[model samples]
Target chain A: MDAWFQNEVTYPHVAQEVLDAADSVRATLPNKYCDPEIAANLFAEAIDEYLLCDDLGINVICTEHHAGINSLLASNPMLLSILASQTKNVRILSLGTLITLRPDPVRVAEEYATADVLSRGRLEIGFVKSGLSEYASNQASPIDNGDRYWEAIDLISKALSHQEGVFSWEGKHFTHRHVNIWPRPYQPTLPRMWSATGDPSTAGDVGRRDMVQVLVLRGPEGTKTAFAANRRARAAAGMPKPTTDRFAYAALVAVGDTHEEGVRMGEKLMWFLNTSLRSAPQFGPKLPGLAPPQAAPGLYRTKPAAAKPGETASAAANAAALMNITAEQAMARGIMFAGSPDTVHKQIMDFHEAVGGFDHLSMIGRSGFMTHAETSKSMTLFGKEVLPRLKEVKTVTAGYNQPD
Target chain B: MTNATALPASGNLLIGDIELEVVRRGVGQPMLLLHGFQNIEPDAPFLDMLGDHASIIAPSHPGFGRSSRPKDVETVYDLVHCYLALLDSIPDEKVSLMGFSFGGWLAAEIAVKAGRRIDRLILVDALGIKISGPETPDIFDVFNKHPDEVRKRSWHDPAAQAPDYDALSDSQLANISRNWEALCRYGWHPYMYNPQLKRWLGHIKARTLVLWGASDGIVTPAYGEAYARLIPGARFETIDAAAHHPYLEQPRAFVDRVSRFLKS
Candidate 1:
């Protein structure tokens, strides 16, 4: 099976745990954790184990959180420079720096370009809107959030691709002076750009921009809306439709000899996420400009009555009483995919067909609360049993050109 | 237009210019506290912490708190320049700078320009460094999700529970929205700061302290350390049992750390 491992690295304390957990998996599977420098040594050790696998790659999605955990690491640009020197053959995907949140798109173009060049064109970028909490905590008004997000994207793209010395933009939210990004990206016309979103509008917007769409498989139904929106938007934007083969679908996956054991382990992790870890407060109070649902009472649940027809059936049900959805709905929707190899294979096929086929299937073998041993077991099971089945299924082609 | 008045009892130099109202307090060892993306008060723990040792100047950056929205000041750098002018108005030859969230980023910019005039700098849960990894969710996204889910994502400390939105007064919500708009004006840029700011840290000669809540879900600790390392000789610390605004959650610990840092 073609396997892609996806994980998040936060600050040092948490990142170390994530790296260690990832290491446990490397002992058994071809895996990599998109991590930062504070966890570099641990990541290096994980790589040592990972390299044992015949075909493997490491993707370091570097960011400021690494610096936030320790004072010695340089800021983003310097950190990217450091990342360039740290490893080889590992694809460096900048999940994305919020280009829209920046005042100078030219600078973003220049920096990411430098990063791509430094990493020998290993850079893959993803852009997103700065979270509302980030804006609020930083004292940015919600009104400017959307405008800034798009503006930054526009400027960055222009600066990265433009052959001329100057580019200009005049928007209601931001104005520029002699816009030009120095030191263009290593890849021709900038490395591939991706946009991450959990919302349909956002997914569609990314497709409209002709960028890759990174969809988090929160649940089966939500995934459907994301796929549908993306497809529709891509078609409308006159961009080539993203086949399941071009997209990456990520979900929390755990494999075991028996379906019950994996489910038990996965559920335990979910309980931790849904309980102990879920107590942190929202950054700021809601704002008027936000959509009604976003500003409404229940968090993360779409209101059932408002659910669009053809949206996930589970999402519609959850929306109706989102604050009160049972664990069964969450499980059946594939929010947390757990099973034996046979079960997992079936689920993968279903998901692949559901999304019209994904180029890569990334499993988050570790999360905020999962321990190393548990993740390792899941990784081992996946590598030995589930992967073979995935490899055998040749109904669809691989997404990107596989590394030689 | 609100009137400009200085408060002798609080030692606050108050400047109310139609669109903005600024409050400056304390004395001896001048320092500036740039408020976050929200309305703040004199009683905020960080302000209270530094009040004892320095001439603490806390301004409601235009379009926040009691500050009116000034048409003239648009970008975050504009606010930075305005604050620089405020420091120039003071009698002290130099000043220490501290900012929280958006203010922290502004302080960095001001310090870069003020150079030798800034003796020390502290940024608490500051924003405006660009790192590429897991996307930091926006406040709106958090609120849309379960409050508990948002909290878990942000706070390292279990004690930092989500705020009871139902309990907040209308005025509080209104103030938050008003300030959020102002924040968008300055922070809408992706990566939050000029990418050049990373390299510019070499220009800032002041001793710096970068502090964050161990559990902060907003900017994440990784972003915090990035800021600290960018500045020469900057130190980093995490406040236990705190989220994005440690000074608000663990006032005593927050103050104690600042007191020790400033003293050193």
Candidate 2:
């Protein structure tokens, strides 16, 4: 199965652990990770190990974390350069760098195109609107986010594909010079692009464009809802129904020799994420969105029961109550896949069947502050046991209608 | 409008001066199926899976099976352009496109260029992106040599591996070789398609679905996820036990997934 390694930190010691874990799972799995700098360093180590040891198909997932307040300042372009120089066969992906936050689409296009060339054309770029914190930190208004996103996408696309002259764009969010990027990507165009979205409307918008969408699994039913919405939007736009081949889903995974062991590990990880991580006194106050408590607890849960008009004091109160109820229900429903390899495999297969078909599956073994060893064991079990069982089922057909 | 039941039982459509034959069946919303490099027919296993829901159109790409070969069209881009023209010839204004294996690469190109006109696009075991993982077997190693070896390379379970390749006839080998050469001609570059295809993917305005055979040997599942992440509003599903041809290996699950997607 295709497995992605989530790089939560950039420490060298941690990087080595992740690399070692990746090596163990490499026999039965494909490994992917985020963070450009860490990826660059880890990739170098991985290549050496791979050459000396057995070859493992490990990939790096790079993200333009425009969500961070100091992202632009913190981002290291040199890391990408290092990655390009260090690795030969691994694919490098810009999981996405926010398009809306940057005013110059040409610059964004040029940077990614350069990266693609540096990586020998293995780059994939994902576009997203900077998170709320990014806008707040940059002192930008949220009203213009969507407009900027579309504009940036247009400018970047034109600059990458149309080779002849400088392409000028006049949009509400950005106006750019008539300058085309040099040294276009190795492919006829730049690396393939995908837009990441959380909302149905956004998913629909991406669907209508026939672009790739990465739907993060917030809850058990979230993928189904998003997939259905996208299909409907595409159909309503008078576009042909999406083929079943274009769907992808992400999940949190923990596998063990026995169901009890898996549950204990998953629970420990969740507890650490929820309680142990130290928070700066000013962190919650400074960034309201970052503080999970500030938002309704159940906001990410399944379809909440609609509030009866006038039943609650305000929408916030009603949402809070609904969320609590939904979380309880989800817990009872056993939505989270935590069990033995056989049980986990069955759960995943059932989930795939329930949501129709998904082309890609991403699992995050490290949740909150789980250790590298914990994550490694989980990944190993997944690669060895869960993946084998998943390969037993039939291939999903190409559905011509939108998903509901 | 002609209903699905009323459609003629004609053979596949032979298009282009090259006489590229495409099998067309059923009616209603148009659905096109593009096969990969294996030279397998869009047999009952595949057609029956998708036939009942919409008008099914399965084409045997040039240089594969019985389809007429195009002397000049060498690269994947040429194949993509040809397919775009084929869609324009169809009576329907827009049709859903599904590409398997190499066909998936062509489908991505078509979706990017045609955008909204193509409607929905599905890519299964697609080979466009240059992924960093286990080196995919060269076409010669897969299509020209022992077919069972190709299957074993991908199939995780010993039971699922195909039988001895020595028993295969000469024609099967010829078809395999021809298709492999075609694939190589189109996908020789380390990163199969334009690196910028990822960036251009955002421009496509059609709903997309990336379907994969979980045990696909040619492309890793990580590559599949990369495709999903690259396409906006795209969804990904992995079918079990299946290798490159999920439609052939896991027809029921494949049909169920497609049926649900179409209905939704």
Candidate 3:
């Protein structure tokens, strides 16, 4: 199993009273609260942590989130460039630029090519089907976002790999009259593409396209459902089965010398869920195209109506459900792997067993008030103790046990 | 056309493949009413009063109310063309066209293209043309602003005029959700206005009336005044103690203005 070290470089120093007063901590809150010096320091420390991960031989993932306290890495390629040039032994995954919000995918392709060249072919491109506050900040419409997502990916892929000179792409969402990038990606074809999504509706598309699909923070049941959807889609399309390496699971992880210390650090990660997720109604339940109109009863009512059986709940509701969750509950739900090295290893193996299997574990090691020293220590402990044991788990052929 | 989960069950018009929820009332003169941000409420008092003056044919825009919206029918250009087809379907008679808020943009576009089909036109708190420099936004962004700010700017008397969300039903909320999504799809970029529409406003052959809510902050009455100036011989008027939805806030006054204009 491949383990990835990820950090969102959150700014968690804001006063609790200020957070309480603001309707949302993202998009709307004035940037005066984000001290530039503190942000700079956070970035520097985060980069250092990535270097430590490189030394530890853990692959690094660069993520992007815009205008939010949740993540300071607003530009994935910027950080991916640093990781590509600075880190010697590790793989750098850009998981990734918010492509749906961007006007041009051709420029994105250029950036990926540059980064891949810098890394000497270690770059892995990932796309995020970003939504909610992203639409508000980036001036991108949530409606038809799906159309844009696929079209952007297609454009980017073609731009990166097309060796046959200038190509014109006039798709439904993107139009590049002259499409060509200099010094095409270092990889023989293109870097392995990955997509992070929680929606079952689009998981099928990811399966058909054969991009690595990462389910972030979805519990065992939700992850299993999405994975099954992917397999079912592949089977329906008469496609060959994949291996476990094609699937990835992302979760908050903390490792310490002792079990008690690790759980305590894991509690600090809850700030990401409790505070940073406090988006206004417009960006949450009221977000256009976030869910079908059938789910409005559960969205609009102060006391939401009980969800009907077989109905898919909105991602907003899922985020809302996690806001007040305790560390114990997080661990129980398989969203967090925390404790001493042995305990954490056991917890990971248990989650691996719960869901059929995933060969890539994307670990969010640093977030919300987690100090740099603590983050580094946790990374060291994870690298030294838990990683070797995890590597023993073999990647199995990917096929959902056909549900009777 | 693929059947959306939402069907225009209450729809009365079959414009080509598109089905629309329409409210028909009164007798005499044909008046095609285009709704604003959301579908016009069937029971709005202005409808009854406006009906007294002229025949009213109000069809909810596709993807609004219960109207089915095919994925292809998402742009303002599509709407303008659809309504033109609607006017053609009416046959020999020239119709008076009226639109509100987002619908006003659609109505204006259609009026420009369907010159001979539309005999007269009315735009109520309409949003279509860009009136100011790019940096200074002429219309308030409803999607980006706080909901409180949106309501406060939207109505002169928000306490009384705002829809009671808690009082609304599951279906009402669902309809609102659908309307919001569709509105975003049509208007999000270039943000509620067609950059080229201002130049084409002069092409409208219909005698036009531009109505506004005096306190409408979403798009100020000043913007409406500028909009009227772009069109040929269009009259501009404002209703007192009202904001964006003048028809909802002061229904009698709203109808009074429309009736007087239609008769003239």
Candidate 4:
């Protein structure tokens, strides 16, 4: 389960008009209602609660996003390093360091390697090709995102593992005469790698290289197909068959004492989903040359067919459709799991049955305008009841409760 | 050649590995028309009106309209070199070069490098110079706007008919997409203007005409004025009741202004 130290000062106080005008999810709402002083307090409270999750035997997931208040935290490595120092045994999954945006992949290798060493090798690196808004804000072209990501990963891997100590890289996106890093890695080999994406081929792309696949909000059917494709790709590449530990599913999760309490918590999660995730991550920003010609439509969920007469499915229409998904619909489709611990447990088991067993269940324990007290309660309940119940349940594919 | 009243003969003119769709009409001193970012319809009314004065040689910019976009022709610098090669390939000693908006920027760039090759240079509603005073509208802002807002800001007629994008064939849509990408490739870095271009304005020797549309919210008439002020002996004129595409909006007046200048 992941505990996000989200900026919650004005979460409950967000005006109706702010949410209404947040049509693209990229638009920044006025921060007049927000008090920056409360942010430090919020972070402190989250840190104490997340340390509690560590004590209760739960591995925490950390991720990154930029520019907007949608995710106030943008530096994953910085956050993870702080968590690593704060805790003793809890594993910190840096659910990603964005590979595509890095001007220097060597810096990425150095930063995460330092984090891994500081954590005494408890860090799991998740490499992400960040969302389009990140590209837009950074002035990085989305057109070159795919190639840049692949190139960055390749260079970072070689930099981390090269026995020769110093090497040169002359790739299409990056070129360095001397590719070497100090304090190579805490682990004997390069640290465990993960790639999170909605595209099915990404699962295979990672699987072929023995990296874990972090399946994002893609639904159950899509997950099943993605997993199968991954297995096939690994086999085709002559790599050993992927175990269930090689897959992880991320979902918006909340647990309460009662089912009704969980639903109440879900209202906040729904707000986050409805407003922040509305237009962004809906269809990728359509930067030209971002994807290959054939991969373009799938990469960016190109314009959907119009539901209304004479109102063609323009960019605005697509954003409207994304914002239209109700919490109930999301729960019914297994996109979210919000209920009592027992209810959430059942949904997880059901998801495991549908897409085979995956050891890591990346949970969004807190979202929307959830307070520190409420979010801590949810995390505590999940770690106490849910984590213990799922400990013995062997992954159907790998027959292990945790990765080797 | 057909009578001056007849429309231009349009065909693909392969220049080396690249093929540009060129439209030639009338017969007299060569008057080259470098179109702006948008597609130049072969039989546009304004082109016909201009054809009455001098031979109109209109070629679609690479990666625009039906022209073949070689991967090598990616930047404004590349375009300048390509066009220079194109001028050398032709037998004409000199040609009158006129450009609108994006093409106007290209014309200015060419004139700076090789002004001797052009007999006259005309720029209309051009965007390539950065002024120091008030902040100008970012040309990239057009992408952020709704198509309706873009059209309203770009033209005097808010209801002006545009290509029915939804009804366009896949190939046509692809061409628009290509042109847009090429535009990004060319203009995304310096953001529609060269930082040092102002220094080179003194090198231009051709008789220069700077035209503008009074209502051009895209670049604003002030942008046009600043551009003309920099060029030596350049004459600046504004057409009433028009915006970015003055030729499209006020064809008769636009042609009359250009014809009078060329004949002078």
Q: Model 4 in CAPRI terms: which quality?
A: incorrect
Per-residue error for B83 in candidate 1, Å, reads: 26
Order the candidate numbers by TM-score, best to worst. Answer: 3, 4, 1, 2
Once model 1 is optimally superposed onto the true structure by TM-score, how far is the C-alpha of residue B113 displaced, in angstroms?
29
Report the number of the highest-TM-score candidate: 3
Candidate 3 lDDT at B35 equals 93
**Model 3: per-residue Cα lDDT over A108-183, one tens digit each:** 9999999999999999988888888888888888887888999999999999999988999888988899987998
Interface RMSD of 1: 7.5
i-RMS of candidate 2: 28.0
Model 2 agreement with the true structure over A189-255: per-residue lDDT tens digits? 5566777664676778888877766655444345566677777788798987665446655555667
Per-residue accuracy of model 1 over A259-315 as CA lDDT, tens digit each: 887776666445323321211123322443453322344322223244456553322
Model 3, position B52: C-alpha lDDT score: 89
Best model per lDDT: 3
Candidate 4 off by > 4 Å: A1-13, A21-33, A163-170, A175-179, A201-204, A235-238, A278-303, A306-322, A393-404, B1-10, B70-73, B133-140, B144-149, B161-174
Model 1 stretches astray by more than 4 angstroms: A1-3, A10-87, A100-104, A136-140, A164-183, A238-240, A257-261, A264-272, A275-288, A292-330, A369-404, B1-264
lDDT of 1: 0.60
lDDT of 1 by residue, B83-187 (tens): 766666666676889898778888888889999999889999887666554464333233334455546765555454445545655555555555655665566
